[model samples]
Target: MHRSGSTTHSLFLSPQHPHSERTKRRPGLSAFLCFLAVLAVSLSPVPGAAADHRRPAPPPAVTAEGLRVLPAVAPVMSCGDVTGVDLRRAAGAEVTITSAVVVSENTPNPYCEVRGTIAPANTIVVQLPLEGWTQRYLQTGCGGLCGNASINYGQAAECPVVEDGTVASATTDMGHQGQNDGSWAAGNPQAQIDFAYRGVHVTALTAKALITKFYGRSPAYSYFTGCSDGGREALMEAQRFPDDFDGIAAGAPANNMAVQNTYHHAWNVLANKDADGNDILLAGKLPLIHDAVLTACDTLDGLADGVLDDPRACGFDPASLICAAGQDPAACLSAAEADVVRKLHDGAVDDKGRRLEPEISHEWGSELAWTLFVPVAQGDPVSSEQFALSYLRYLADPNNPRPDFELTDLEFTKEAFWETMQSSSYMSAMDPDLGAFKRSGGKLLLWHGWNDHHISPQSTLAYYDAVRGTMGKHAVNDFARLFMFPGVEHCSGGEGPDSFDVLTPVMAWVESGRAPASIIASKIETADDGAETVSRTRPVYPYPAVARYDGSGSTDDAANFASYTPKREIGPDYKWLGSRLYSSDYQTWCRAEGTELVCGQHRGGRNWLSREAGR
Candidate 1:
C-alpha cells in the first residue's frame, strides 16, 4: 500500500536493454553469508542509530501534500522516463520511507506501470537495495508486484507499518504507472527493464544496501519477501542470481510457468463459455459462493472470526452446496454449477483421465484472475481466453500480432504452453536448480494457502516434492522451509486472517542460525462471535506437505491441517522410475521429453544428482 496522496495509472506492452543482470563471478558461501549478516544489522534501527534521514537528500523532485519525493535521477532517468518517485534522505541513507508515487514509464504494447509506496520514505531508501542500487522504489498493491498486474485493480495506501517498529516499513507499487488496461512497456525499454526484473530486486537490494550505507554497515542478516509472482521473482533471483539475498520468503510461487498459463486457459474455456456459451459463475455469484465457502470452512478452525486457518483440512466440498429438491435456489449450488467449481478446484483430467496442467483459481469476486490462475467458471470467458480456443479460425500466428497480456490465448495451447513459451519467455517461471543456493547456506521459505484459489496449492506441493526428490530432504530442511495457510486466497487477503510477518523466522535462521519449525496462523472472529478463538500451529514442512494439521482442531485450524508428506508412493499407479526431471523410465518417459535437460545423467529418479541432472 502507498501513502495517502499518490495516484495510480496503467498501460500495457513490453521492453528493451539487452545487457542481462547476470553477475560474472559466482560468490562463495562464506562471502555470501557474511554479506547477509552485515545486511541484517544495517536494517534494524538501534536505540541511537542517528537521525536516519541524517544526510542531505539529492533533491525534491515532487511535492505533494508537503512531502518531498526524490524522483528518478540522471542515470535511471536517462535510461527511460522519470516514471517513479523515490523518497529517501534528500542525501544520506536511513532506508526509511517518507512517501512515494508511481507514474507512467510509458512503455508500449502489452505492459503497464501500476502504483507503489513504502513509508517514511527517508528510512526506506536505506533499508532496501540489492548491490547498492535503488532505482524507482515504492510498494505495490494487488497486481502491483505481480509483473505489473496492479493495473487491473485499486490499492488503498496508508501510513507505514513496521515489524520491529524502530524504523521498519512496507512497500507497494514499484513506482510506475498502469492503473488501467494499457501497455506502458510498449514505449520505453528501460520501463521494461525495471518491470521485468529490476523493480523488486533493486528495491530490496537498495533497501538493504542503504541500510548498510546509513548505519556504517549492513544488517546482521538479510532476507527477501513476496508471494505468487513475487514468489516467482524471488526464486528467479535464487536460481539465476543466487547471490542476491541470503534468506528468501517464497509463498505459493507460480513455478512451472507453462503449466500455470495452461491451467488458466483451460479454466477460461470452462467457466466463461459453457457448452451453450453462457457464463456460470457471474460477478455477484462469486461473493455468494465465497460466503458459502466461508460458512463451511471458517469454523473448522474452532474460532468463528470468519477465518479459516487452513483450508486443506477443511474438507468442504462444492457438492455440499448443491441445491437439493427443497433447498433455497439462491444459496444452494445447482448440480451443473457445482460441477463447474469441482472442475475449477480439481487438477485437470481429460476424457482419458490424463492430468493436464495447473492454473490459478477463479477469484470469486475480483475481475483479476486472483482466485484461480485460470478462472474457467462455466461462463463467458475473459477477452484473452476467447482468442485461444478460436484462434485457429480467428487469426494470424501466435506471435504475429501478440494478443493482449504477456502471453496470449493461441499461445497457451498445451504444446506452446509447456515447451516453447516457457523456455523462450519470461513467463515460464519454472524452478531452476538451487543446489548451489543451498550449498551457500541460503534459506528459503515457501508457503501455500490450502485454499489458494490461484495457482493450485498442489503445484507448490508438487514443486516441493520435486525439490526433495533431488535436493535431499534434510539439506532442504537445513535451509528451506514451506508453510501452508488455510483458506487464504492468492498472496493474501481472503476469508482467513491474511496478515503475517515471516521475516521474523527468516532473519532468525539467517543471522542467529535458528531455522523455523512452524509459524502460527490466527483466525479472529471479529463478528458477534466475540472472544471466540480459532487458531492452529502447524509444522513448516520443508517441501512436499504445503501444511496440514493432524486433523485435530476444528479441522479449519492449522493445527488440524495434517501434514501431507507423500512417501515415494511407488505403486502401479505411479511408478517411481526416478525423479521426473531425471528418469527416462516408462512413467517419467512421457513427461521427460523437452524438460530432460534439467535431469541428471543416470536418467532415473534415484540418481537424480548424477552429472546429468544439471544438464
Candidate 2:
C-alpha cells in the first residue's frame, strides 16, 4: 500500500502516538468520559424516526443448519482489556483500537462499542452485544463520498435482530474525513481505492477478527445492507469479494457511478437550463405535472392509488401538459418547459441523439423530487450539478485529474462519454457475473424505488437482466431476486409506501432456503406530538410483477393486493454509448504503484461490440 501524501494523519491519530498512550494509562478517568459520550449518542433521537418507522413484523422462525446460539456469559475480560489486542500482524496493516466501552443507555441491550482505524486511514466502529449474541454479523455501507463514520440500518428497521441489538454491526468511513466534495480523491490513489471498494472489505476482515477474539468464535451468518452508494458497495462485495457476506440488501444503488455522475446526473441540470442559463421548468409546477401524470396513467394496475406500479408503462406525454394559447402559466407548461421534460425523461444524448445512459432517466411519478435537478431559484445551483462536478474534477479519469474542472467543461457528446467510462472499472459495479457469489450460497435482494429521483431504476433492471443472461435465469433465481417499489423515491420517499424490510427476507433466504414472494411496505405518518401511525400498507412483488388491487378489501391493507406480472417487459438491453461497458470484460483490477494508481482489465478480454457502438 502506497502512502505518500496520505491523509491518515489528519483523519486518525496513530495508536502508538503519545496522545493515545496517555489516554490508555488513565483508563479509569478516560472510561467515565467515554461513557458520557456514548450515552449522548445512544440517547439522541434519530432523524425521521417517526415518519420512517416500520411497524414490527418479526420474520418467521427457522431452524437452519449452521445456526448457533452464543453461550449466555459476560465478557471474560474487561471492556478496556481489548485495547491491548494488537492486530497489526493479523490485519497486515497498522490496526489501532482507540476505545472500548460498554454502552447501555437508551439501547435495547448493553453492548461494547469499539472504535479503531486501519493503516493509512479507514476509521471503523464495531458494536458487539454484551449478552445475547445470535452469532450474526451485519456490516453497513456509507453514502455519497463517505467522509463520516456512522452506522445506519434505515433499510432494515423492521428486522427483529437489528431492532433488538442482538446482532453485531460495523461501519467504516471509507478512509477519508471530509464533506461529500470529491476533494479527498485529489492526488491520493490509496484513498480513492479505499472509497471504491477496499474500505468495506478491510473493515469486514478487521471486524471479524475482533468478533472472534471477543466471543471465542466467528459469526454463523454475515450480512451487508446499504442504499445509494452503500448499495453500490453491496454489489461490489458480491462481485469482487464473494465470500465476505452470506446475504446482501441493496437499494437504489449508484452502481453505474462513472457515467451516472458524469452524464446522467449532469444532464439532469444541464438539459433543463435555457441558453440564458435560466431554468426552463420551474419547481413550483411539479405538483401539477405529477397530478397530470397520475390522471393519465394511475389506474394502469387497476388502482387509482397515488403511485404508478410501473412508471415505464406510463405514456403520459409531456406534450399533453403544454398550455393552449393565453393559458395560465401555473395551470400548464409552456412549449419549452414541455420539451425540457421530454429531454429529461429521454436521458442524455449525443449531438446525433445517441443515448449516453439508459433510455429512461427520471421516472413518471418522480416529478416531485425533481427539486434535486430543477432549480428552485434563479442562479442557484441544483443538487445534481454539485454531485456531477465533484466526479468530473477528481474521479472521472484516474490517469488525468482535473481539479480546476468547471461545470461548463462537461460535454454531452459521444467522445466525452467514453472519457468518463475510462475509470468505470474502478468506480462502477455493473458486472453481471455472480457465479462465485452464488456458489458460496450468497443470497442477494436488490431493490430500487420506481420513482427514484437520483440513480435511474432502469439501471438496476438492466443489471438484473444481464445477470440472467450471463448465468441463466434458473441459476440466478436461486440466489438473486429484485423487487421494484412502485411509488418510492431514492431509498425511501415519494407518495408511496416506502418503509419495508429486505434484511429479514434475505436472512431467511440465506439461512432456510425460503425465498420471499412479497414484502409488505408501509406509508407512515407522524403526528405533531410525535405519535407514529401507519396510513397505508401495500405488498411489493418481485420485478415485472406488480401489486394489483384484489377488489374485495381496503386498498390500504396489504392483504387486498396480489402479485400480477405485466405483459410488457421493463428494461431490454439499453441502447447507449456506454452500453458495451456493462459486460465483464470492462471490469478492472486496480493497484497502487508508487504514488500513482494503475489498472488492468479483470477479464483481460475485449467487449464483443465495438467500443463506439452507439456512435
Summarize candidate 2's per-residue lDDT along 206-273 as a digit string, tens digits. 88878777887777788999999999999988987788889999988888998778888888888888
Highest TM-score against the true fold, candidate: 2
lDDT (C-alpha) at residue 114 in model 1: 16
For 1-615, candidate 1 gives per-residue lDDT tens digits of 111111111122111111111112112222322222232222221122234467744332322111123222222122122123343432222233333222222211111121223321111222222122222222321232232322111111111111111221223234345422223333333333343344454455544443343333434334456676567666655654455567677766765433444444455455444566566654445556667766776666445555444344445577777888987887777777777766665445444544454322332222223333234454333653533332222112222223342322334233432333323233223443578678766778778765565566766666666566667877677777777664566776555544444554565465445565555444434437443333432334444344444535464444455445555531122212112421122111011122121211112432332332233
TM-score of model 1 (CA atoms): 0.56
Instruction: Give the per-residue Cα lDDT of candidate 1 at 155.
Output: 11
- CA lDDT, every model vs. true structure: 0.41, 0.77
Q: Stretches of candidate 2 above 4 Å error?
A: 1-74, 568-572, 605-615
TM-score of each: 0.56, 0.88
Q: After superposition, how far is residue 303 of candidate 1 from its true place, in Å?
A: 11
Candidate 2 TM-score, true structure as reference: 0.88
